[model samples]
Target: MIASTIKTQYEGSSHDSVLYSKPYSKKIDTLNMPKGYQLPKFMQFDGKGNLKQHVTHFIETCNNAGMEEDYLVKKFVRSLKGNAFDWYTNLKPEFINSWDQLEKEFLNCFYSTRRTISMLELTSTKQWKDEPIIDYINRWRSLSLDCKDQLSETSAIDMCVQGMHWGLHYILQGIKPRTFEVLATRSHHIELSIANHGKKEPITDFKKDKVFAPNIDKIGKKPAKEAFTVNTTPIKTSSTPIKIDVIKDSTQIKPSF
Candidate 1:
């Protein structure tokens, strides 16, 4: 009885020092890779992607490789990298006793914080002045997924439209697509048409020295006086023949009748 108790204490000590339970460690230690079984490529979660997605993908890959709960619980830490690895290392020993508990803790640790950050990003995200319709819409939709609890299709459309450039928004306002998909499609169509054809620019015809309106500064200044001037004050004329004398180089003309 004393020997069995000592063995239990030793096993419990081993389990309490790591992530897996004592039973999980025992099963995982005895398991061998199947003959010709190649290790499946595990996804490295660095905390950038959706936490739930990362966990789901990790489980799927491990399951496909015939890893049962024991292996999953024991080996999940191997898949972590960067911030995720740091998070795993900081977990209290023996706190996570099963695969489900570990997965739950992983989600609880990262998911809410990520969603909050994503929500802020979504609120502040804007379509760049030169960004294409396809690219901007794609990015906006991706950000929405992280914070999409209350986001409806109409609200999604509104958010995208609000983030779009004013010129794009003006055109989109006129089109008034009813659904987000239709909006994306029509926006892309607008983009393609603009690319294939072009925007209408006002064609202005110009001529030099024909300005009806002068420069604002120039308009305030009086014209310079001319050296030569012609005077025609109804020159005295008998209804008969009158001769007006003028020289080629003269400035003023005097008519005599």
Candidate 2:
């Protein structure tokens, strides 16, 4: 009877285990998602300004990764380093709860009014000596974005042309490009033309003789001076029959009668 009871208990346990058994499912690793699909390293905010760029990049990166608002807030806080981390930790619990609120506060803390003024001043930027036209244009365009008022395409093209080197600017002026795209294309061609022209050897008129040439005879000798032997004696003539001899040197004549 004891052997039979143990056998029956064993059979019942086996049946229960089979009924409760689950198939193994592979666990998904969030950190090691497909190669390029993995989350990017968090961008740390330094207090040196450019808060807009830093925050924008962070938001864009998180959005691309399909991170939810909660994850966004957590990742942003985790990414902070040094003073930034300390400042964030000290914020009220409510302030840290909303990602949008956090971003707004972050910008308020870092973005300065002076930066906007500086951006406005960029409209007056002139091309620096030896600065490339393309570089000047690119810098102006970048600064324009930071301004409170965005620059129009025509205004941007004008600013770019105005900042260009005088030589290039003069050439582009004649082309009279109505659009920024046209201006850029024309400027590129002009720049290449100038560069190619500089590389060329200037054509010479070998046909014309040089004004100054080496005189082998006069190399070491002093220039000759004129000497005249004048005849002071009056001529003795009978009925205008008198012979006069004139001696000529390099610069004067001596007469004998």
lDDT of every predicted structure (CA atoms): 0.69, 0.63
Distance (Å) between predicted and true CA of 216, model 2? 32
TM-score of each: 0.46, 0.49
Q: Report the lDDT of model 1 for residue 16.
A: 43
Give the poorly placed runs of model 1, Cα more than 4 Å off. 1-38, 46-50, 82-96, 105-135, 150-155, 162-185, 188-257
219 in model 2: Cα distance from truth in Å?
Answer: 33
Q: Write the per-residue lDDT of candidate 2 for residues 1-257, one digit (tens) a residue.
A: 88878987766556654554211112211223334556677778756656777778888888788775545665676567777775675564343545666777777776544456364487578888877777777777777776777677776677668778887877766666777667766676667666655666232212241233333365577767656555544566775544444444544434444
Give the per-residue lDDT of model 1 (tens digit) for 35-130: 666678887888777777777888888888877675687678778899888788767545655687778788877753454435567878999878
Query: Which candidate number would show the highest TM-score if scored against the true structure?
Result: 2
Q: What CA RMSD would you report for each candidate?
A: 13.4, 18.0
In model 1, state the lDDT of residue 255: 66
Query: lDDT of model 1 at residue 6?
Result: 94
* Residue 223, model 1: Cα distance from true site in angstroms: 44
